[model samples]
Target: MITRRDFMKFVGGGFASAMALGGYAFAFEPLARLNVTRYALTPPGWTPGLKLRVVALADIHACEPWVSASRIASICRQANDLGGDITVLLGDYATGMNFVTRYIHSSEWSKALAILQAPLGVHAVMGNHDWWEDKTAQRNGGGTTFAHRALSDVGINVYSNRAIRLEKDGRGFWLAGLEDQRALIAGKKWKRKHIQGLDDLDGTLAQVGDSDPVILLAHEPDIFPRVPTRVALTLSGHTHGGQVRFLGHSPMVPSRFGDRYAYGHVIEDDRTLIISGGLGCSIGPIRFGVPPEIVVVDLG
Candidate 1:
C-alpha cells in the first residue's frame, strides 16, 4: 500500500506540471503558431474559367510582447506568397488598452503591409479598435486618419462604406468594403449627435449592377445577419477566434450572434459568411487552440 505522504507528494507534483503546461499553452504556443486556412468557395452558379483568390488578414495588433513590425512584415510576405488575386485587410492594427500597451505608429505597420499586392488589388476596412485613441501612447485623435493615409500611400484602396468593381478573366464582381458598424453608431460621444455616414449595405450595392456577383468586407461579423440574400459572400474578422477554445468550440466568442457567427464559414439563406480567426492577439496577448491565421478564400 502507498503511504499517505507519498500520495500527497504525487498530487502536488501533478498540479505543478499542469500549471507549467497551461502557462506554455497560454503564452509561448500562441506567439509561435501561425496557420494558413484555405477554403474553396463555389457559390451556386460557378463561373467557368473565372476565379478570385482573396487573402484576408485581420487583428494585427502590432504591439510589444506580441506582434512587432518585423513580424508584421513577415506576415505580409506570407500573404503575398499565397498568390491571391485580391488581398483584403480587416483592421485593428493598433492595440486598444490603457496599460502595458507598447503601440507602434500606424504608418510603420502600413509600411510592412505595403509588400502585399495582387492582380485585382488590395482593399481594407477599419475596425472599432482603430477608432479609439491610445491614451497610454498619447496618440492623438485615434489612428484612423494615419492608418488611412499610410495604407493609401502603400497603394491600398481604403473603403469606408464603398464598393469597388473587380474583374478577373473576363468575369466581373463588385467588392464592397464596409466600415465598422459599432464605431459609426455606438459610443457616448455620438449620443448627442446622430450617427452620420453609417455603412449602408443598400447604398454600397447601389453602385453595382444587379446581375453582377457581390462580395462584402465587413470588420465585424455581426453584420453578417443583416446582409441581403443576393450577396454571394461576406468576409469579416473581429472575434479573434475567442482567443481560446475548448473541444473545437470557442467559449468566449464576442458577438451578438455568439458562436453562430463566431469563426469560419457558415452557409445560410443562399449566402456564405466567413469570419477569419485573425492574425494577432488582443487584451492579454494570450491565445489557446485558436492560433494566428491568414485566410485564403478562392471564389469561382
Candidate 2:
C-alpha cells in the first residue's frame, strides 16, 4: 500500500535523524556529560551483618580535552563525597584512542587517583589498554609495566593476581585483583590469534586461604563465565557500555557475548557481575546514550 514517493520521504526523514544523532554523539556527549550510577543488592550467601559500600571507577582512558589529571582529581573528589567504604579502580588508566590532542601521562593521572579516600583503602587493577600502551611489558612478555609502577609510586595499591583481607566494623572479607586478560599482545610466545592474557583466576582465589566471602576485581567482564560462586561479586569495566548504546541495545559491544556484559549488574546462575559503564572513551571520541559514569555498588 506504500507508494514510491511516500517511501522516499520516509527514507529522507530517517537519514536526517541519523545525521543529527551522529552529530550529537561526536560533538557533545563524550566530553560534556557525566553520571553517577548506583546499585544496591545482596548477593546469594553474602555474609550476615556485613555491609560494604564500593565506589568503582574504570576505563579512564585519560587524555587531554577528554579526561585530564585535573578532571580525574575532580572525579575522585566527587567519589570521595559518596563515602565509599572501599574504592576500586577497575582498569584502563592509559590512553587508548588517538583522537586526543595530547596524552595524559600515567604519573599525573595516578597522582590524581591518590585523592580518593576510603576507609578500606584504594585498590587498582590494570586493564588491556594499560598493558597495550606499555611497550616494555609487551616486548618482554612479562614484567612490571609503567602503569603498575606509576600507580604504586602514587601510593595506590595495584593488585596483580593477588588477594588481601580487609575488615569493616570487625567483619572480614577478601578482596582479590586479577591480572589483565589481554596483557601480552605482540609477544613471539603467542602463536594463537586470540588474545594472550596473564590472568590466573584459580591461583588468585587459592591465595585467599580463608572462608570469608570474596570480592574479585577484574578489568574485563569476560571472566564472569569462569568465576565460581565462592566469590560474592565480580566487578569489571572494559566494554564501556558499547560507547554508543541506544534503547539498552548496543550494536557494537567489545565482548564476545555482545550486550550480555556490556554494562550494569548481571546475575547469572546465582553469581553476580557488575560491569561499570566507565569514565572515559576509547577507539573514537564519541559517546551516545551510555554516558560516562562512576558506579557505586552497595553489597552485603
Largest lDDT belongs to which candidate? 2
Could you give candidate 1's per-residue lDDT for residues 1-300 as a string of tens digits?
Answer: 999999999999999998987887666766788899999978854456678898999988777657878889988899999999999998877776433346788788888988888888889988766654434312342334556677898888998888877788778788898866655333453352533224677788787775778889998888877888768889999899888877768887877677888788899888899989887776666778788999999987
Task: Give residue 244's lDDT in candidate 1 (0 to 100).
Answer: 82
Q: What are the candidates' C-alpha RMSDs?
A: 3.7, 2.8
Q: Which whole-number lDDT from 0 to 100 does residue 125 have in model 1?
A: 89
lDDT of 2 by residue, 36-150 (tens): 9999999987889999999999999999889988989999999999989999999999988999889998889988998998989999999998988888888798778999998
What is the lDDT of every predicted structure here?
Answer: 0.79, 0.91
Model 1 Cα displacement at 116 (Å)?
A: 0.8
lDDT computed for candidate 2: 0.91
Work out the TM-score per prediction.
0.88, 0.92
TM-score, cand. 1 = 0.88
What ranges in model 2 sit over 4 Å off?
1-19, 187-194
> At residue 133, what lDDT does model 2 achieve?
89
